[model samples]
Target chain A: MSDAEDVMIVLDESECWVLLRSHSLGRLAASAAGVIDIFPLNYYADGSTILMRTTPGTKLVEMTIHSDVAFEIDDFTDEEAVSVVVKGTAEWLDTRSAIEEADRAPLVSWLPTLKYVYVRITPTSVTGRRFVRGPEPERD
Target chain B: MSDAEDVMIVLDESECWVLLRSHSLGRLAASAAGVIDIFPLNYYADGSTILMRTTPGTKLVEMTIHSDVAFEIDDFTDEEAVSVVVKGTAEWLDTRSAIEEADRAPLVSWLPTLKYVYVRITPTSVTGRRFVRGPEPERD
Candidate 1:
């Protein structure tokens, strides 16, 4: 179903608009795709990127097998909340230096080691949504 | 790399644990997930069982396709923050009485015309991490 309302509320209002603006396209947040090792990454608006360390032989290693990925980061508050979502293509880091520069060295989460190296996400589009609490506009 | 050091320092101790304990499962400090009919539904815990509301339409429809999905709720104090990840199975609810009891139906984030429906999530595992402020963590 192509109902915009069903999946994501992509309206032209400031709330949704703010969300799209919050996406750090070149940065990535870690989330489960396979095991904790196969953590997700993202792109930043400035073309730079960010991500926590990922390990080889991890689920992340398997997930980046030339596929598209979705990355999300969000925050919520009483008056307002914002979320950023990015869709992009991903590939593994080819050189060890590139991986080190990205700060994605061998690391651990819950366990002591991971399997995957680095995942480079080339973003296609990034968007966000926000909900602001209190007050309504005066009707003209 | 199953190393615990590989973990990212997500939310501090308090916020991360709070979301894990909150009875609401969905709404709390950080409301997340895709929206419905212009309404922001915070699907929590995991998509295996979602705890959000929708009047009707594709919001409810699209999620039914796969019982598996991801739900994250995040919070922060100053520059430090953490995100909770729940990965598991999702189930759709189809009951009038049950729908009326949804969290978003009435006074909480309510809309008069909107309908209330429930998505239940049963998480297989819930994990979290965030960054610690400072130059870095000193090794133990």
Candidate 2:
């Protein structure tokens, strides 16, 4: 009934955005000084942009050094798995108006630490895929 | 009874390794052409290295351009969240013996696509943190 194929299915841009809006938690990837790092954080998908909050730490520093980043969210069951990736440019919401705008996005920190820095990632490209979980096909 | 603090707790190296071994799915982040990308893939923890299989695609191409990559795994409940990040160098298992060795790992493809390329990530630094999930602490 679904487009669920024998294996992998490519998801369209709209599907990717839908998945992004449905999930609040994701991994943020950024590179700094030749090393790339991934951190799991809470984020809000505001229209086409991804909003997140962070404190003065490695995550913020790395993104500051390199504006290019990738944010990913995924979910899976026994039968299927889906993943969405957004390659974007990250910038801190430094202006008062921008910070006030981000303050309303419902993005909250998981820990008790102060996360005064509001960062937003504007997507350069969004892509997604769906994979049907199954055993490997026998080799010829 | 546990070291579950009210907020965030830094996990030790041994604890990080334990968590890594307990999970099979993670996000691998790599940078290419000044843009970073993250992919969710199923992987096997072989001793201190991460083993995975993939078809010829963007994930493999980017990682080849920059061997410095980050692999991350995370899990969370309503009460707590834990994440482990491994900053590592990824190398394709091209040799006959190396590919044969990787074949022994309990790694299988989730899709029917031919994933002939086997890759291994050797960790340079492994770090983890545990966050006690709760509402933000009231400020003074």
Scored by lDDT, the top model is: 2
DockQ of each: 0.18, 0.53
* Poorly placed runs, candidate 1 (over 4 Å): A1-45, A48-53, A96-116, A134-140, B1-18, B21-50, B78-83, B103-113, B127-134, B137-140
State each candidate's chain A TM-score: 0.53, 0.88
Q: Write the per-residue lDDT of candidate 2 for residues B1-140, one digit (tens) a residue.
A: 22225478899989998998888899888887676778888889866898987776545654654388889999998899999998888888788999888878888556655446777889899999999887775533
Clash pairs, model 2 backbone: none
Return the lDDT, model 1, position B37: 12
Predicted candidate 1 versus true structure: per-residue lDDT over B51-126, tens digit per residue? 6544556444454334444555544444444556655555566666655555433224322233445665565656
Error of 1 at A60 (Å): 2.9
